[model samples]
Target: MIVKMLHDAGLRSEHAYLGAAASIGLSLASWLASNRQENLERADRWGIFVGEWAPTFFGLGLALANYERTDGEQLIDSQ
Candidate 1:
């Protein structure tokens, strides 16, 4: 249902995968920024919080990929 909704909403697997990648980058950036501005504990918390999003995005990407494969939309191109 979520995959269908995402598809209907025009969100492809690549978008989720890109979001996952961006989340990782954001996690690092957040950690660095917090470390510089705040402290190690805050930085760790920020990193952990942002880092957790990657898996959810990756899971959504996988689900969308499977949906695309079964539905034959080819929304995400192999490259």
Candidate 2:
């Protein structure tokens, strides 16, 4: 249901996948930037926090893709 609502709102699987990729880059950038200004522990924490988002985004992307596939199958069958 949530996936359908997200799809209806124009949020596709590609967007989620892209977001996951971007999050990984952002995490690396954040780690580098923070390492220059803060302690190593803090930098590691910052990187880890940002890195965690990638998994959620990936999961969403998979769910959306599955939904799209099944939905497409239903549409074809109904015709």
Candidate 3:
């Protein structure tokens, strides 16, 4: 259902994949910034929190790709 909603909303697998990649960079940046501006513990927490989002986005990308493949006919027809 979520995949269908994402597809219907025009969110492709590429977008989700890109988001995952971006999240990784953001996580790194956050870690570095927090480490410099705050403390080691705070930086670790920030990095872990942001790093977790990558997996969810990757999962979403996979799901969307599968949805696109399985429902390609219908999607193309609609378009």
Highest lDDT, which number? 2
Q: Report the lDDT tens digits of candidate 3 across residue range 1-79.
A: 8789879999999999999999999999999999999989999999999999999999999999988888987878898
CA shift at 4, candidate 2, in angstroms?
A: 0.8
Which scores greater on TM-score, model 1 or model 3? 3
Candidate 3 local Cα displacement, residue 20, angstroms: 0.4
Regions more than 4 Å wrong, model 3:
73-79
Model 1 ranges with Cα > 4 A deviation:
73-79
The worst-scoring run of ten residues by lDDT in candidate 1 lies at: 70-79
TM-score of the candidate numbered 1? 0.89
lDDT digits (tens) for residues 1-79 of candidate 2: 8999999999999999999999999999999999999999999999999999999999999999999999999999999
lDDT of each: 0.94, 0.98, 0.95
Candidate order, lDDT descending? 2, 3, 1
Compose the digit string of candidate 1's lDDT tens values, residues 1-79: 8789989999999999999999999999999999999989999999999999999999999999999887875544432
TM accuracy, model 3:
0.90
